[model samples]
Target: MENKIAFIRQHGIRVRIHALLVDRYLQTYYDKLGWFSDPYEVFRDIVNDPDKHYIFKSILAKTNVSKFDLPNKEAYQDFFGVNPVSSFKQLSSHCSWTGGCLLEKLERAISYDLPGLLSSVSKAAATPAPAKAAPSPPPPLPGTCEGPGCEEKPKNRWRKQ
Candidate 1:
């Protein structure tokens, strides 16, 4: 019974780490696109894309679970009832939960249990804030008429010839 409890705890930690890594990977991927209006929509699009999905699966397969104190893929699959690919996708689906996103949970876990991972992710995603671009010159200052065809005319005044 003690061994079973230990195994469960170990498995939970591994699952949490795996979820963290997946969230980091997805955030980096979406960040490269400049802007994503809705993170959930982008996530769904990425998950639906066969090529992208395969790449994500490959990342999971290549990542060293042992470093996170988890068993190898085959063993994990045998014990968890699902392969790493399926497990990753399932966890990622929970990232959009209303209570608290999986990434937020992962962040808290890392902050408490694995500060190094949290620091690494923060450094990796720390992009310089894009320059402000001069606030776009504040439009045209009402209706001053600056365009090519914009002619200056008196207010409500008509020409009589």
Candidate 2:
């Protein structure tokens, strides 16, 4: 649990820094409004703008896909090999306001399948482990080792030490 928290903290810092760098680059090249925009600006915009908020949520849903969708692990690897955010941004550029109908399709698909997907995941996770078989009885104690009045040595006598 501590390891997971530490990882999340480190990952969050990297994401924050990357977002800052991207914001700085865009402002320098596109906006030229230095100090006026920062990493928090986009976040603030997402909070303030209802449409942008939903767009961001839709993109998040798209990346967290169903595990069953891919045939092989390689296919899963290839699917996530490309950055979904970059793809969404590029695809969304086709429409300035809401990216034409892509956002709608994405939201619709998630809404349609998320419940069943979540339910299946929950069911699989909740399934109990198989019961183990009872252990075989121990061999009759040495010396008392049974074989119709046999005379096997005691176990302690067999120890090399």
lDDT of 2 by residue, 1-66 (tens): 444444554454444333333333233333323567664454434333424334333323545433
Model 2 pairs whose backbones collide: none
| Local accuracy of candidate 1 as per-residue lDDT tens digits, 53-147 | 45345544755344435334444324333332333443456655467676557445544554554455566668677777665566677658787
What's the lDDT for candidate 1?
0.51
TM-scores of all models?
Answer: 0.29, 0.23
Residue 42 lDDT (model 2): 49
Q: Every model's Cα RMSD, please?
A: 22.9, 14.8
Worst 10 residues of 2 by lDDT: 83-92
Best lDDT among the predictions, by candidate number: 1
